[model samples]
Target: MQKYILFTVLSAIFIVFVGMGIIVPILPIYAAELGATGFALGVIVAAFALSGGLLQPFVGSFSDRHGKKGFLITGLLIFGLTGYTYTLASSVGHMVLIRTLHGAGSAMIVPIAMAYMTEISAGKNVGRYMGMLNIAIFSGIGAGPVLGGFFLDLWGRNSAFYTMALLSFLAAALVALVLPGRDSLTIEEEQGSMLSVFARMLHHRKVMGILLARMATMIIMVPTFAFLPLLMTRHMTASGTEIGMVIASRTIVNALFQMPFGSLADRYNKNRLLLLGSTIISIGIFSVPFAVSFVTLLLLFALIGLGEAISWPAMGALAAEEGHLYGQGSMMGVFNTAMNTGIFVGAMGVGALVDVLGIAWAFYLVAGFLFSSAIIAAAMIRPRKKTCISTGDKS
Candidate 1:
């Protein structure tokens, strides 16, 4: 591993994510504390995703042409600034406006870092490196909630915000000192206008296929987060602690297995892994109605986590390889856009579905949609075709 590039980037990302996690579990309650109603609270939560989704592609394309470090540093600063200002938000409306800007900061950071990661890593190890990067995310996700609870209990709300601000500042300073300056633009990426660049990247059938699958994967995943707790508590009589345990189990599995699964993507058939992993996730989701017992429910959620561990490394590897062929930053932007869009659409759309069609049918619809996408992914990106598509890497 290149300690300066990979380790430093990972450290910055992990710390940023910890800040993110610290705010997430408490944001709604904090909004209510500020007199936000249900709909207002939803708006406060969605603001970040709305802004992030809109900005991610542009940030990515620009970074490819100019440099990643500047945007990365700027994003961290925005995040740190937002963390500090969070202490000043007096009402729900204030938080919503601040959170919207906060989303842009979040958008700018991760994809560019991903592009930089690919820029520095060996081609053969893209999957492994990406998997390693994901650990920072997983660790942050795991740590954030526990820490959020602790901070709220002990240090108070304002202290958590200050601590988060401090972490983001530390992250920014580390990246500024450690990572290299501007990257040289790739020949393939440098030739086109912004609109044309996106057109060319999206024109590839495989890119569309992979991106759609990525979106669909998030759709399935989000519904679990949105609806599962409701079902567990309302029907199964599961306690809040039990519900949290089940959720944490998924995060733990994902964090633990990402590296091993990433290693497998490097060593074996990526499409086969994608196929198998999606199938496992589908199985877990489709059987959710049957998870009557607490232990059984936990196992199902674990299966979903296991499938995520197996599947996402391959998805990320393919995206990086495409970025190598076309444009690293732009392609990563598209990938991130797919993620945010999925979170937004999945949460809203499936929440609607649950009201009209009922939970069982909602799970089936999402699972079926997700399961079929694996076929599209496999059919569109064949092994030989994948090799043939790399016209030339001019990096």
Candidate 2:
């Protein structure tokens, strides 16, 4: 029964993400066709991320005291309804407004769900469990573009938008019916403010180092993927199917490899793997500007996907361990905030680069950034001297 509940919840989450993912290869082009400039298009992507990132900490902190289920349900409702709003957007402003609402909904769901999972799966092989969520995440996202691109080829933009709306509503319905309501928020007044907890987390060398590495990971990812499709379509004369396949290649590799690497993280030195993975991703990103064929680009994306599969599961295990020590919701909030921040900054910044320097420069600059950030992470994120410690918390 518990297994069924878990599967249902995960499935619900995955379905909604398929909705979200369907827009990936389509949205930027849609915005541009609606008379948005390069910078405006970047803002379109960044707006959602900015709202999501900024709201996550506060919402996560609140959920720690209130209940995750309420926020999860409410957020999914907003998320579901907002997809239809995209079809109605006539201006960049309309898109931004819808994106802002969508971002808020995103902030509430994933991190809170993560906190719930981490808390429940205590003392288990957390990496493997958390990595399962990646399967749902990647598969939904992977499949979304494939279907979206097909719909675009057949019906047009509105069809894809409507599909997104339908899936979000489906996810909302599933969660309402299937997921258990466990409002087990056990916060004492003496535990200090969320700000204070954040301050402590900030000062903890291990936590901060991990956080920095995670932040860097997203900084490299968000911009590259956001802009790569644009380059593929414009420069390579790629079809929607080709573009979707190239993007989905990464997602497919990510979904396939997560659990295996996650299991390995339980037995191996995760910090080393993180460093190595970052380096591999850098290689993939740097090689992108040189690819002239669809097959080559697809292989490169797969390389990046392999790196992500290797590193993220390890990162998740470490994050789950830390969330247990601090406050689960708070830590997961910060963890997610790092992801959104990267999306926001990377989208905006890379958009500017695309406008000013060129698409090639955007690729080159992000690759350099990825390599440099990996170096810094390798230098900073050292393992603790003692092993098998009960708590991953540091003061």
Candidate 3:
């Protein structure tokens, strides 16, 4: 990737993820303050994921038929605008609506940005490049909560929203200025229907497997963000700032570990790394309920973060390798949709479970799911003795 393009992708990812992370520690409290019940809070959180999930296929198809840059620009603009509107919300209903809009932007941006990255990066270095992209994600996730917590303490929750908005706008501006010009398609191609693209994507087996795994991982992950704060507060008497610190710690560890894990995936069997990651995640989830102090929670969160670091880049590299059979845009779109749907379901299910069954059981259930996913990943992933034929290069 060109230095400028890499910078643009990183900046855009940082902006979107930071905006998301800022809300993670305080969103449930914000919903409760707005008079939402547990179910309502679940709905509010799910609304964003649902909207983003639904839009992915359409946005991706449009980008494939049209060009990447237009969708990239449009998506970033929408993200920035809707992100600002969160400050204006007065109730959970309004928050849900705004979050849905934000999800729409998410659906457009992620797949296309990844596709653009794939197009620009050399096949030999794709895993490393994707790891760098994930580094951007973890950086945003790591820093946002710490900064948000500080702002929440000093200024207020509203200040966090404004800060997110400002960062998003700056990112959009950077993308507008630095990204290469939009690719052109002939008139005949421009007239092609998006449904045709969707139909084509559905039949790709490699894409389907990667998407399923991506979805499963997200389902395992989202619940941690959704319920961990409440769990910490209830069990350990953690304040908001301390909760943010724990969250940031996870991201910090994730960022620190991703590049090494990505390099490992390149050298060894990506599937093996994936299995190891899943096992770590399972262990971490199981440990969460046993955390009796902030220090314990931090340690468990670090384990979870390490698991995430191993899984994400390997998944991306695998998806990218598989995607060569289809188009990169289509595969990424499907993957993003599955992932977002998992997030939506996981967040809502965990919240509801907490209300009905209890928080401890919810953590156990999520842990079971993670372990099950690990087993499935082990059974399904068969590493080729030779490097992938499509890339024509050894890791």
Candidate 4:
């Protein structure tokens, strides 16, 4: 039953994210066509992150008490609708409204799915389980960009958006028809109110470290995802396929490395591993402005992906370990909220920086922030203590 649940949940996630992946490279270009400036682009992405970040905790707490399947299904349906709605947008403001709605739908999906997966795992080898989930996510995302590029090049922009809608709807139907109506594990009513739980979590050193690390790592998204396409267009005049391949490189590398890094997370000092990964990511992002060719950009992005692959399972495992103390749904909600908030900050900050200091400086600033956060996270995460047997005779 657990295996079945994992498989079903992962399938739904992969399908849904493939739809999301399909739009990633295309969204900036589409928004650009609607006269969106760098600030406007950031506003659009930040809107999604802010709305999703705000709603995630509440949604997670609600799912903890009620059930996860319903929220997951509803989120997928919303994604589908949002994809189609993109075609109807005439201005950046319209996109912001649409993205805000899309974010609400997002608040229901990934963190809820994470909670459900964690619950079924029985808290053992959590890194491994999260690695599997990441595989589904990264693989779907990896595949989507390639297809999105193809669709855009051959069938035009609307075709890509239409495909996103179709894929999301299919994912929703899969979850509705295939996944169990309720999770195998049950949550007790005495888990406490959301505010109290959050207040307590905020004071916990390890949890705070994890949240900060997550937020800091995510701060690079706007510079990488939202601005990279623009950079490539202006610098290299890269084709859509070329752009997709560059983005896909990072995701594919991350997906490919998940299991191995996840295993390492279980065996090593997770905080140290996370710090190492973040440093690598910072270096990669910092080097972006120096890339003179498409190949260099692809390589740099892949390097970033490798860094993420190392960091993600470690982060996921830590969150899962913490989940036992503070309801899985709530913990993942907080965890993902940190992620969204990071993106929100990145989008707004980087967008404005691009307007003032230029895109290169924006990457430099984000990279600096990531490195600083990584150092702080490493300092804050508690090291595991070793157990030893005592000998009667003294040496």
Candidate 5:
């Protein structure tokens, strides 16, 4: 059961992200062509984050009582179908609506996948399993931009969208055909209303600390993925392919380091790792505006990736530990909500900063926010005694 669940979930997520990735390098440029200003771009990104964040806790809690496979399939199908709608968007409003729908699909997928994985993993090795999951995620994302860029440079912008649609559909099909049904996999646990679960979590200091730290760290995503191409265009000459390569550099490095760092997370102090990792990320983001050449930007992004690699698995393990008490689906749902909230805040904040000051200020401001979060995390998160959960030995 563990082997089957791991393989199916990882494979599905990889394909879905690859489809998602193909658009990251070009989506902002596409939006701009439709007459979107900096703030308009932020609106589009925030719309997705907001819609997705709102749905996660409910979907997660419901999945805990019901079954996960159905929601997973439905979400993947929604995700695949939404990719085609992007090509039909004629105005920024249209784009925002489509992205909102996309976020709904997102609300169903990754968090549920994390919940499934946590359920089947031995408690002592949560970080190691999470590391494996991250490798699939980072690897797909790392490969995606390059392919998107290639399609854009060779065929046209629309080609990338069409390819994304195809890949997403394939992923949905993969999950439906291979993963076991609800009865085979669902683990019954005591679960309450989503709101009740959320209320309890809000009062739990360690969980709040983890959620805040996750949100703060993720705030850099908007500037890094959505605005980096704009920054590159202003600073120096860059092609679509070059922009894709720079983005890929970070995720690829992150994928490469997930295992070793995951092992460290299992053995060492997770909070210290979080601090060390966030500090590194802050330094990398702060240096972004200074990068004048492609190589320089690539190296800086790679440094950020390394920081994430060290921190991400540790964070995942902590969340999984908490999942043992709160229920995995419910815990991951709220966890991912914090992630979306960070991205939404970053999108709005950075977009306004770019319009008011310049693109460079966005990077500077996010770096400062992340550094501040590291301090708060240090104060709130403490080392916990390890406990192991058994994975039933079943085929």
Candidate 6:
């Protein structure tokens, strides 16, 4: 039953992400079609991210106090239902509202699922579990664009949303049947309120640094994926399918490298992996602005994938270790909020900049932020120490 629940929950997460991935390449185009300006598009993207970011901590905390299974079901149902509304959106406002709702559902689902996973998996193998979870996520992301493009080709834009809706519904049904009802962590109010807990986590030098690193990594990523199609179309004369291929290439590389990277994290200094990944990501982001050809763009994105493969799992493992004292759910909530906020800021800010300055400048700006992140990451992380304990020889 435990194994069934774990696989089923993971599958649900994978399917939910498929819906997210399928929309990635097409969303900006949809916004443009709805008469949205670049700034408007940025706002539209940010709205969803912001809503998710703001709600995640609360949802995670609530799940910790109450139970994960209920929130999981509620979230999945909302995700499935709200996903269908994207097809009905006639304006950017409608799209923004629906997207925000969709993000709210995601906030409930992701952190709660993560908390559940932490409970189910043994402490020593947490990184391995996280790697497996990421496989599900990246696989969904990898397949989403290809599948989305195919559906769009066959049935058009509305078909993409309808397909996503169906997937979400199927995932929800799977979760309802297979996920066991279990509450893993006990909540102690004396540990602190949510705000205080967040503040305390922030005060921990390593925890804070990890959060910032996560944010920086995501900030670079959000803009790259968000605006890649626009850049491809405007600069390289690429079609939607070609753009999807470029995005798909990144995910393929990410999936390929995640497990190996996770193993490396277990064996070596995880911080080094974090540094290496961030540096690689920065370089990839920096080079993306100069990618004038489709092949060049694909190669650069693959490098970005490699960077992500190293950074994400290592970071997750590190966070798990740091949060060993705190409840995993609370720490994960904080982490999710940081990540989602970064995505919000990156997407909205870069989208606005693209509108004002140009697409090239936007990519360059993201690259700069990533480079800065690499520097900060190196400065912040240190080697873990081992303590030797001894007993008296005489009895």
Candidate 3, residues 149-238, lDDT tens digits: the string is: 777778888888877777777877888888767652211134245666566556654455566667777776555766777788778878
**TM-score list, all predictions:** 0.83, 0.93, 0.91, 0.96, 0.95, 0.92
On lDDT, the leading prediction is: 4
RMSD of model 1 against the true structure = 4.4
Evaluate model 3: give its TM-score. 0.91
Tens digit of lDDT per residue, candidate 1, span 66-161?
778889999999999999889899988799899898989988898988887777675768878888878888677666655765677677777778
- Winner on TM-score (1 vs 4): 4
Candidate 4: the clashing residue pairs are: none
Q: Write the per-residue lDDT of candidate 2 for residues 138-185, one digit (tens) a residue.
A: 888888888877877888888888888888888888877776676543
Q: Which stretches of candidate 2 lie over 4 Å from their true place?
A: 184-190, 384-395
| Candidate 1: Cα lDDT at 250 | 66
lDDT of each: 0.76, 0.80, 0.76, 0.89, 0.87, 0.78
Query: Residue 257 CA error for candidate 4 (Å)?
Result: 0.4
Q: Give the distance in Å from residue 193's predicted Cα in candidate 5 to where it truly belongs.
A: 3.0
Report the lDDT of model 2 for residue 306.
Answer: 94
Clashes of each: 0, 0, 0, 0, 0, 0
RMSD of each: 4.4, 3.1, 4.3, 4.2, 5.0, 4.5
Q: What lDDT does candidate 3 reach at residue 250?
A: 83
Residue 168 in candidate 1, Cα distance off native in Å: 1.8
Which pairs of residues have clashing backbones in candidate 1?
none
Indicate the TM-score of model 2.
0.93
Q: Where is model 6 more than 4 Å wrong at Cα?
A: 184-190, 383-395
